[model samples]
Target: MPYTTSPVLPPGTLRRSPQPVLATGDGLVLRPWRIEDAPAVHAAFQDPLMHQWHLMASGSEAEAVGWVERWLTEWEGERIAQWTVADAHSGQLLGRVALRDIVLADGLAKIGYWTTAAARGRGVAVRATATLTRWAFDAIGFHRLELLHAGANEASCRVATKAGFALEGVKRSAFHHPDGWHDMHLHARVHGE
Candidate 1:
């Protein structure tokens, strides 16, 4: 069955312009990633808390550089809008946030984030996620944004809730970890809701 609806955001919406830098209003900013951030990225991956959930190992700065390069291209491709969450004045890296798996026609994307150990207890994830959510809805015209995290990730759940994402339900065995499959909590926020 062919259902008809206009593309929610339209083509070239993201590709037409350079990615933007956004402020969290609490001394944090979300900006585009750069190659110079490789050292910080490598350090973030080495943190036990970050490694536990993301399971990505940036053993060398070179690998982190590749990740940054891919993120840069992903913006031009309109697939993902990744940002570096940083201190506004010092420009120190605090965390990372992104709208991944963006679908222009559907106007939907998945929210993802993680914070460095020093930024964890200070609500960096929540602010960055909320800041990105606002931009995705108001600036880019995304109709809906979803945030999914392992059911065991209480910190992420708190971030989602604080960012105004309502818990929709769980996806059983939705994601794979090194140990086994795990249930994922699905949270979402729709434009105007």
Candidate 2:
């Protein structure tokens, strides 16, 4: 096969740069996860909503430490970028957001997020999502960003919509939850859109 096109982004695009600390005008900061956040990470994962929507869970503080460590290490590979969404001034853990499953050749990645119980209803998830989306598109030059959620997760759907990601379609029986398989909503936004 003849290769003609260059990668949308060169390799090391992320690995070579320090993960940034982005601020949401609404007072949230999306920064790289730290080892000290393990306690909060452990508690956040215990939230029933987190368990319901996401598969990964931190059963103990030790496991949370491992999760935090893994999130940091993944940066070296530049495949996934995770951030701890915190209060800008106090640095209280508000939530988390990430650009996952990155494919630099295609300038694409999947965005995922969750808010702590206290952060819910405060626009934390929406602000974090929008902030990350802008950074992924404008700063990282990703051509497209996708946000998928279990079809029944109306909250996530709302976050995607508010963050400017259009609903592309649904994939039936696409995601397997602890209870059973669930439909998945595929929402996306192109760089200029």
Candidate 3:
């Protein structure tokens, strides 16, 4: 989908944008990524469990910094929204989830997420995704949210299901992963449905 941006706002005027940080259930919080999060994100990417479920491209510290920079830029423009999941009590970074490829005209977006090995099995991704989806639909007025996972990544498929996303279908060669083209299971949730 083609990207679109909202009109610029006047100085000192309330722009009515979505909140940058959201607190999730129990002990987790979802918020925008900060530059200081670079090291933690780099460490999370190195987790073997994370690598097993998600594709990770080799990169140096400079590349990771660049990635965060891009995310910040996108968030500033309201083109894409990403949230870093962290422990509500301690404020430790756990993972990240993003609502990207947004089409404001259609009220649609694609959701993507990943968690560090330490945060697995605690329902962090599921809670964060569900909370984010609700925020998107309610605050942003999005009507539909889609999640696509590699067919082989059963864990991610399970997360989508648990988050109330219905399995839409499986598309052959839907994504190009690090290994090669792979089949993907598409899932979606619609507002008030």
| Ranking of candidates on TM-score, top first | 2, 1, 3
In angstroms, give how far residue 164 of model 2 lies from its true place.
0.4
Q: Backbone clash tally for model 3?
A: 0
Q: Comparing 1 and 3 by lDDT, which wins?
A: 1
* Candidate 1 ranges beyond 4 A from true positions: 1-3
Give lDDT per model, in order.
Answer: 0.92, 0.92, 0.81
Off by over 4 Å in 3: 1-19, 52-58
lDDT of 3 by residue, 72-188 (tens): 767645547788899999889889999888666567789999998889889998999999998887766777899999999888999999999999999999888767888999999
* TM-score versus the correct structure, for each prediction: 0.97, 0.97, 0.86
Candidate 1 lDDT at 19 equals: 91
Candidate 1, overall lDDT?
A: 0.92
What's model 3's overall lDDT?
0.81
